[model samples]
Target: MTYAEILSHIYALGRFGIKPGLERISRLMAALGDPQKNLPAVHVVGTNGKGSTASFLSSILTTAGYRTGLFTSPHLISFTERIRIDGREISEDSVVHLAQRVMAAAPPDTTFFEMITALAVLYFAEEGVDIAVFEAGMGGSRDATNILDGLLTVITPVALDHVEYLGADVPEIAAEKASICKPGTPLVSARQVSSAGEAIAAKAAGIGATLYRCGSDFDACWKAGKLEYRGVGVTLHEVVPGLHGRYQSCNAATALAAAEVLSGIGFPLERAALVGGVENASWPGRMEMFDGEPRILLDGAHNPAGAEALADALAEIPRGKLVMVIGVMADKDREPLLSALLPLADLVVTVSPALERALPAAELAESCRRQGAAVEIGGSVAGGVERARELAGADGLVVICGSLFTVGEARGHLLSRPFEAFRG
Candidate 1:
């Protein structure tokens, strides 16, 4: 099969529509010879920071002379972005070959995410990767990727997310993520609510997994123009992560803890590799800035927690007035997301992203209005970004956020140089 044919076949799997259980993926992987079991893995799961943490860990392992495979979800630009080896995205040939193999193994009905997860494992194993970092696509336990055994399990900050699937309360959500822990696999986690932390600790103990809790077993501090990370047999100073947002310090810390645990398991990562990875790793569509006057900031703040982080980041910039161009998925917690962002905006330009699941521009405008922000509707993401730039004048800030799809659209606009060039 050709690359285009592979994509078409995988896209056709979307007809199954997001099966939230591991039975189908487990069966599919078994038929494919359980490729996931042949490779060592670091499983990263949480409501937020999983992608950044996974990227950091993968980069560190690669710098330490290990062949690393990184798997993430909800690609910003292309499907290939979901899988990578040593920072290079999966090639067309690799995608085609793997898709053909997986299609042969899968049942007549399979979800898109399941096929992709199986492909990632097969590709990583075939490439002989020394270590693979897998990010959970959604709630753990039932998540397709959780079917694999992990040498080190890292959980970033957990919050209220995926209420429809995971549960409305923090403890219920924490329990779902904790299901990824396996016996003899050391579990590392950030400090969470007391109830949530207890639930995770109990799960780890039940499975004979040593629990390494942040703030107790490991910690990170951001101060004096540096990020200080300290954990068992690991210490770093003045570390600067490539990603923005103060919350990244915690993500870096979680990665460090995972690295330390992996070292104990004989992976043996050097401190230099750890430092280099934190400083050099990059993940797009999270507080990504473009080069131009009336600077454009693109963030994928699709959930309430993410929106709050975006709001915090915006507070640090000294703009005359902030003009925001926003779009969001229809199924998201739109009210909470808009409430978090609208307070920081001087004016809001709502637009529809180029995705079938996008909330309509008029609906987004209504949400903004309800949040007490001056709002207008744009026909498309590009139009919204242009309008935001025009309203921000020469020295103001124009932020485009609310969804990864929105950020992707903004990136396409920026790359095409659709806006008028500015002279400083």
Candidate 2:
């Protein structure tokens, strides 16, 4: 099949929606000769920071002379962005070939995520990668990527985001994420709330997995303008993180610890590889900024916890009046998400991304109004960007956020790039 035909075939499976169990994926992998079991894997699961940590680790491994494959979700522009080796996106021809292979072997009622996960694992295995980092799509226990028995698991800060599918509270949500831990596998995690920490600790202990919490086991922080990372049996000073924002320091630390674990298990990484990897890692659509007369920052902060982090990061940067261009999914918890960001905005330009699940611009503006924010409907994502730039003027800052779909559209518009039509 051609690229367009193949993409349509895969996107059509999205109608099956999110079936969170691993049965279908497991069956599909088995039929494909179990490619997932053939490759060494590292699983990164959390509400946020999964992609960044995975990108950091992948970069580190690649720099250390290892063929590393990185699999992430919800590509900002192209479908090929979901799979990469050595920071290069999978080629369109590769996607077409892989999609055909996966479709031929897939079981009945395969969801989009399931098929995509299978395709990634197969591609990595066939390409003969030394290690592949798999970022979980959603909750851990039954997430499609959870089928792999990873060398180690890294959990970024667990928070309440997917309440309906995962759970309603932090503890319940943490438990679902903690289930990614395999027996005897090392688990490295970022500092969590008391409730989330307890749940993750309980799960790790029950499974006999060694747990390493960031703040307690080892930590990373900026002291005197240099990144310092302290991990199990290793310490690095003067580390430089490639990504922006204060929160990335924690993510770089988590990736460092995971890399240390791999080295301990005979991966042969040197101190230079660890430092260089963190310094070169890059993930788009998270704290991404485009500089111009009116600077535009694009972040995929759809939940309250993420919004709070973005707000804190914004507080440290020196910028003029803040104009927020926002859009979110229909099922998200809107009130708390908006509450964290609304106060930071001098004006809010609401928009609706071109997707089935997006909340209408008018509805989002109403919610912003209820919060007593200065809100206006910008109709579409592109319109929102234009209106926000006009309102922000030359010295002001324009922040586009609330959903990855929104950020993706704004990014495409700003960069003048064409993204795939089916972004479901």
Candidate 3:
């Protein structure tokens, strides 16, 4: 099959509507000869910060002279962004080739993500990568990517998300993520709810895995505009992660901790490499700022925790006024998300992302209205961002957020012109 044909075939699997299980993935991978087992990997799972942590880890591993393969989900800009090697996206040619091979090997029925995961494993194996960093698409346990036995598993902060599939509470959700840990593998995690932490620890013990908790075994602190991380008798100070938001300090430290664990197992990453990687790593659609006089900030703050971080980041920018353009998926916690952002905005423009799951613009505006914010409905993401820019005037700032879908749309619109052109 041709590349277009391959993509069409893969996209057809979306009809299955996100099956959360390993049977299909396992069967599919087995048909593909279980390529995932041949590649050394670091699996990252969390409600938030998984992408950032995976990107940081990939950068550091690459800097340390390793051919690193990174597989992440829910791409902000392009589908190609989901797979990469050494910071470059998978070429169209490679995608087509892998898709064709996997399609031929896949079971008669397979989910889109499962097929994609299989393709990533195959590509990583073919490229002879020293390590691969895989981000869990949802909760860890039954996530298709969990089929692999990774060298290390990193869990970032777990929160109430995907409640329909994972659970309705934090502990239940944490249990699902903890399911990714394999026997004897090194597992690392950030600070979590006490009950959730206990659950994860119990699971680690049950599997005979070495569990490293952040606050207890390793820690990080921010001082003087720099992040300091201490773990395993090594300390890194004044480290600035390329990704913005104070929350990123925790994610960066988590990635560093995982690196230390890998090194302990003889992976051996240079200290300078770690520092440089953190300084240079970048994850788009998370507080990404476009160059302009009235700077436009874009973030994918779809949930309450993410919204809180976006609010904190907005507080640091010195703008005369803040105009927020937002869109969100229909299933997110809209009330809390609006509560986190509306209080930080001078004006709110609500819009619907170009996705079947997007919440209606009218409904979003009503939520902002209930929060007592001056709101307008913009129908679509482009319209919302444009309206926000107009409302911001010459010296004010325009912030676009709520979902990666919204940020991706805004990015495509903004990239059409030179960055200076967006300036007020």
Candidate 4:
């Protein structure tokens, strides 16, 4: 099929909606000859920070001279962003070719995510990657990416997200994410709330998997002027991880811990490579800022936990005022998200991201209004960002957030105008 035809076919499958089971994915993999078998991978599971941790692991593996494949979800701009080999996104031609092949072989009722997961595995296997890192699409237990028996499982902090599919409470949600652990595999987790930690530990114990908690086992910190990583009796000093945001320091540490664990299991990872990898890992749309008089910051803070992190990060930057351009998905709980973000905004402009699931701009504005936030309705991302920029002029700041869909569109809007001061 052509690229447009391929994309239309894939997106059309969204009508099937999120099917939370592994039966179809397993069947699809079998039909494709099980490309996932014998593939060394690191499965990243959590409510937040999954993409960042996966990016760190991919960077570390690649820096150590290994070919690595990275697969993430919900592409911001292009479908090509989901599959990457050694930091390079899958080419459009490759995507077109793979989509046609997989669709022909897929079983009836296969989902968009499952088909994409199969596509990634096929590409990684064909390319002969040394390892692949996968971000669990949602709850880890039955998520399509969980079909792999990754050598190491990295669980970032667990939070309440995708409640309809995952679980309603933090511990229950944690249990779902913890299900990614295979028998006797090494699992590394970031600092989770006590209940989440307990649930994860319980799940790991039930499965005979070795659990390593952040504060108790391995951790990284940016303290006293350097990045200090302590993991598996290996200490790395004065390191600087490539990603922005203070939370990323912890993510780098998680990646380091996984690297050290891999080394114990016979991966020839050198010290220099670990140091270089941390310093070079880059994940866009976390706290990405363009240099300008009034800098534009794009963060994919769609949920409460992510929005809280964004608020903390925004608090640190020295700006005259903060004008936020926001959008959200209809499924996300807006109360806590708005509570966490409104307190930091001098002005809020609500927009509808270019997506089928985006919450209505007027509804978002009403939510902000209820919360006592000074709000305006921009209706669209481009218009919202323009309005925010106008409010934040030169000396202030325009922060675009609420969802990756919003930030993605804002990035395009800002990046396209060559005359905009924020343009690179």
- The candidate that wins on lDDT is 2
Cα distance off (Å), candidate 3, residue 360: 2.9
lDDT of each: 0.84, 0.89, 0.85, 0.85
Put down candidate 3 lDDT per residue, 1-424, tens digits, no spaces: 6766776677778777778899988888888888887788888998889999999999999889889999998876666788999999999799988888888888777888888999999999998988999998885778988888888999999987788998889888888888887788989998888988988898899889999998989888888878898876579989888998888888888888898899888689889988988888999888899867577998989888888998887777788789999888897778988989899888999999777788999998888898899998989887888888888887899899887778888887887621111100
Residue 152 lDDT (model 3): 90
lDDT of 2 by residue, 1-424 (tens): 8998988889999889888898899889999999888789999988878888899999999999999999998899789888999999999999988889899999889999999999999999999999999998885788889888888889998877678889889999998888977888888888888899999999899999898999988899988657899888789998878877788888898899899889987698999999899988888989998999799999989887789989988988788889999999998788998999999999999999988789999999999999999998999999999999999989999999998889988888998987554543
lDDT of 1: 0.84
Q: Weakest 10 consecutive residues, lDDT, candidate 2?
A: 415-424
Model 2 TM:
0.94
- Give the range of the ten consecutive residues with the poorest summed lDDT in model 1: 415-424
Candidate no. 4 TM-score: 0.93
Error of 1 at 3 (Å): 2.7
Give RMSD (Å) of candidate 2 vs. truth. 2.0
Q: Write the per-residue lDDT of candidate 1 for residues 218-318, one digit (tens) a residue.
A: 89988775799988777889998888878788888888888888887979988899999888888888878875779888888988888898998787767
Number of the candidate with higher lDDT, 2 or 4? 2
